[model samples]
Every structure is written in structure tokens, then in C-alpha cells.
Target: MPSETPYARLTPDLVLDAITACGLWPDGRLLALNSYENRVWQVGLEEARPVIAKFYRPGRWSDAAILEEHAFALELAAAELPVVAPMVFAERTLLHHDGFRYALSPRHGGRAPSLESADQLEWLGRLIARMHSVGARAAFAHRGNVDRDTLIAQPVRSVLASSLFPSSLHDRYRHVVGRIDRLVAARLEAVGPVRRLRLHGDCHPGNVLWTDAGPHFVDLDDARMGPAVQDLWMLAHDERAMEALLEGYASMRDFDHAELALIPALRAMRQVHYAGWIAARWHDPAFPAAFPFAAEPRWWEQHIIDLHEQADELE
Candidate 1:
């Protein structure tokens, strides 16, 4: 059975009330509600601006993850970096009425880049470096000795164990997975311990926007202290994108060869991670078919296969 709409339980009057309670404009009509995860409306009250109302599911992510995102948004804003600034109505108590958390942010006035533009990529590099300088420090001010073995092993093995790929791409994907597995194993043997750093975690093109201001980053739910390369892996193999992102980052920070090598591994890992996430939500009613990969099973399957193949090629 299809799950109820995110706002199914919420009436127009109640939604208005929620909007009012949150201190956002309550008069504007809800323009769109996607797969029940988030609601977007044009707020005429705020000079006809667009603002998004994001609703959090209970079990999808941890409270720590939410808090971490909150920290990232505020810290980036403080640094004067171009990012979506989220406002929490009640701080720690975002959800007083429902069993979900809520946040409101200005709708970034741009679309996800349909084509890779060098200018945009360059901007991305500069922006990411700035973000890292300011945001990285705060997340790890109080840090822990996060184990590498588990981080690498769990995600990789989970993909293999769960059989996330469709049967059609089994051969192609198997070769790729095998190659990545070998490379990961070799890295473990050679390096012994994996290095750690603060990361945006999900730095995909979908999460980054090209607005009038420049490239603006939106989602930070996956923000955490982990291998820095882990963040790069989220981006697809758009060389222009990588060139722009890396060159921009290099301008501010220095990354060694080891970190560069880890890029391929992290990319492969991220592909597996995302593919698994999609597969898990395949049956979810609330999961919107907003993503390109949603209706394109063959594309997703091939992506996983290609990632592993690239891993093999790297080895």
C-alpha cells in the first residue's frame, strides 16, 4: 500500500497553523509537495520569495545527523560562504506537534546543473575550500577515534551482501565490485590506517546548485568527520567538475597522493552506497521519482557496474 502523503495528516488549516507556529509566512499556498519528504511554497508575505519546508522522517536519519547539518548551515553562513541557511523554529525542539523534525530555508533560486560548466566547477572548488576551512573545524572540535576498518568494510560488504544490483548487470557489476574490493584490500594492507577528516559526505551535483550568487550547496545531512576523499566520491566522473572542484580546493588546502588515490575508492563506495539506498526505497511510497535514476533501472545498474570497472581500471 502507498503510504500516506507527508501532509496527509495535515489539513490546510493545520498546515497554515504549522507554518505560523514556525514563524514562516502562513498565508502562501503550498506550491508542491514531493514524495512527502518536503513541502515548498511561494511566500508572498516575504516579498514573494520561495521557501522550503523540510519535514524529517523518524527513522531515516539520526538526531546527531540533523544537529550536524544545523551546525554546518550556521557555520557556513557565519563564514560568509554561499549556502542555504536553515532556520529552526524551536532549536532542539523542531517537532512539537508531529513526530517529525522541521526546518525552513530560502529556496535556492536555481536548478541543478544539467551540463558541466567549467566556470561553475571552478566556483565549486573555491566554495568547497572556503566551506572546509570554516565548517570542518567546528564538526571535529570534539572528535573521536573513528575506526577505518568498519567504515570501509561495512559499506562495501553491505552492497555485495544485499545484492543491490539488478540481475541484468550482474556480470558487469561483479567485475567492478571485485576490482574495488581488491583495491580497498590492498590499500588497507599498504596504509594500515585510513586518515580521517571532516567531510560534507554527500557532495553530489544534485546537492549543489548554480544560483545567481554562484554554486550554492544545499543538503548537509551526511555531514560528518570521515575520510576527506569520502566527500569527493559523491561527485560523478565529470572531469570538468573534478578539475574545477579540486583546483578550487587546492587553492586553499593541500591533499597528498594518498588522498588523491582514495578518491576512486570513495567514488566507488559512494556509488554502492547510493544504489543501495535507492534499492531500499524502491518499495517506499513516499520516495519520489524525482531523481533521474528513479525510472532508469538500467542506468543505475550500469552506473554501479561502471564504478566498479573504473575501480578495476585504477588498480
Candidate 2:
């Protein structure tokens, strides 16, 4: 594993070999591959059982992050949120190899919800609301200002400064960062203290799946102490779909001014995190094509335009 490669670390044979060594998975064949910050392979066993083996980007995350997810997934499941639970197998104590960390979970059978479906959007909202309710009932407060500053600094210092992207693209992202900074600044001025709780940090469409068990959420590697609204904002970023989600969430709980105020900044932050992550791992074999660079730049540009227009609304 190179220090700078954004790719996942496992090949099909390697993953199958690992599983077979455990003696639980037999005659399993790799069926599909998925990657973002980590690489995940969907494997089909001889018995028709499916499981997902995930190997994280070397040094991008830590063992503690995965442990936090397991703890919170249990909490959320106890509160009736639909989360995919991974079975514990051998050497599962946060195994480390080739400078990367890896973990395994059951393969969820359903696909990510399409934006074209209102029913899916509604289900997403309700699922988020239930997760929020679970967080509200938790004991601790949100962790403050940790990853936010790093995200803001990345484009100007890391991505742009690194020369990994073309000069034209670098300038475009710099402008996006400027716009994001302005929105975040204004939001901080207007929003009051927000209640914080444990969150599934990456709650976007990709992490959500419509399954036989109902709407199931996966990829809890970023789980940490943060605003539940962070999770909600990611799902509700698009206006029409967001409106449906808000309607569903509101059916269960009331929203206050501060939570609403944070949406614009959070949305931009979500994009920033995504762009940095995608750029980091573009060369990885398992990198998903859902938001290719060609499409993502346009999306971020539109976000900047929207942010400029909606700054006052958020304030």
C-alpha cells in the first residue's frame, strides 16, 4: 500500500483466502466491488450466503473508528433503526496489514435508493428520523470543530497545493472552498448552540439501501460525536427529495431554528469531504463510478451557486 494511493487493498482471491482461512465461508466467489474511503467486495458463498469484506485506505482511518461504529450500531438497532449488523469472525480485532485496516460485514441485498423515487425518499426521511431519535436519547454531547477545519483547509493546502489536480480544476475548487467558507461563517453567526449526539457520519444516499428488512444503513466508519443534523443534511441536500425527507422527519420530531440554520453549511461540508475523498482514491480499482470527477465538479459548482443565493435563508 502506497502512502498516497486512494484505492482499496484487497483482491478477490486474497479476500476469499482470508475468509476460507476462518472456515466460516466456503466456496465463496467475489460478486461485486464497491469503494469510497474504503474498498468493499460482495462475495457469494456456496450456500448462497453473501457478505461484504471491506479494507480501508491505509492511515486514512483508525481501529477506534470501527469500534465506535460497532458500539453505536448496537445502540441504533436497539432503538429500532434499520442498520446492517456484521457478524464477528476470526482475527476481527481490527486486523492491520500493509498499512491498511480491514473489517467485514454481511452483504446487504438491496440497491441504493434512486432519486427518481418519492417512496424511497420518504423512507429515507423516516429512517433518518428514527436514527435522530436514537441519538437524542443518548447521553453525551457532540464533539466540536474537529474534522470541519481540516476539511476546509484541504483544497487550499492539500488538493490545490499538491498539484494532483489540473490548474483549472484547482482554481474551480478554490472558488468552491471560498463559497463554503462564507456560508459556514454566516451560519455560525446565526445558529445557536446545537444539541449533539453520536452520529453515523456518512449518511448519504450511497450508505443507505432499500432492503427486504426495510431501509438499511451501512458504512459507519465515520461514526463519532456530532450533530444529528449532519446526518440529516446529507440525505436532504437535494431540494425536492429533501422536502420529502423533512416532511417524514417532522412527522416524528420537531425541528428548531439552529438545526435548520446548519443545513447549508453542512451540505457544502459534505461535498468538500466527498471531493477530498474522491480525489484521494481516484486510482483505486474499486472506486465507484457513481460520482465521477466529470460530474462532481459540476455538482460542486451548482452547490456554490446555490450557497450564494441561499446564504440569507440559512442565516
Tens-digit per-residue lDDT, 1-315, candidate 1: 123344455445555565677666655566654333344443334545666666665465566666666777787888888778776554643444454466677776667854366666666667777776775575554322223333434544444444344556566666665666678667646654555666676677778777665668876666667655555545636666666667767788764436666665555555565555555444444444554454565775667657757676557
- TM-score, every prediction: 0.74, 0.77
Best by lDDT: 2
Can you give the lDDT of residue 223 in candidate 2?
Answer: 69
Report the C-alpha lDDT of model 2 over 106-127, residue by residue, as the tens digit: 7766777776577777777777
Candidate 1: where is the Cα deviation over 4 Å? 1-14, 33-48, 90-93, 113-116, 140-179, 188-195, 232-241, 288-311
* CA lDDT scores, all candidates in order: 0.60, 0.64
Query: Where does model 2 exceed 4 Å of error?
Result: 5-9, 90-93, 96-100, 114-122, 137-147, 168-176, 237-243, 282-315
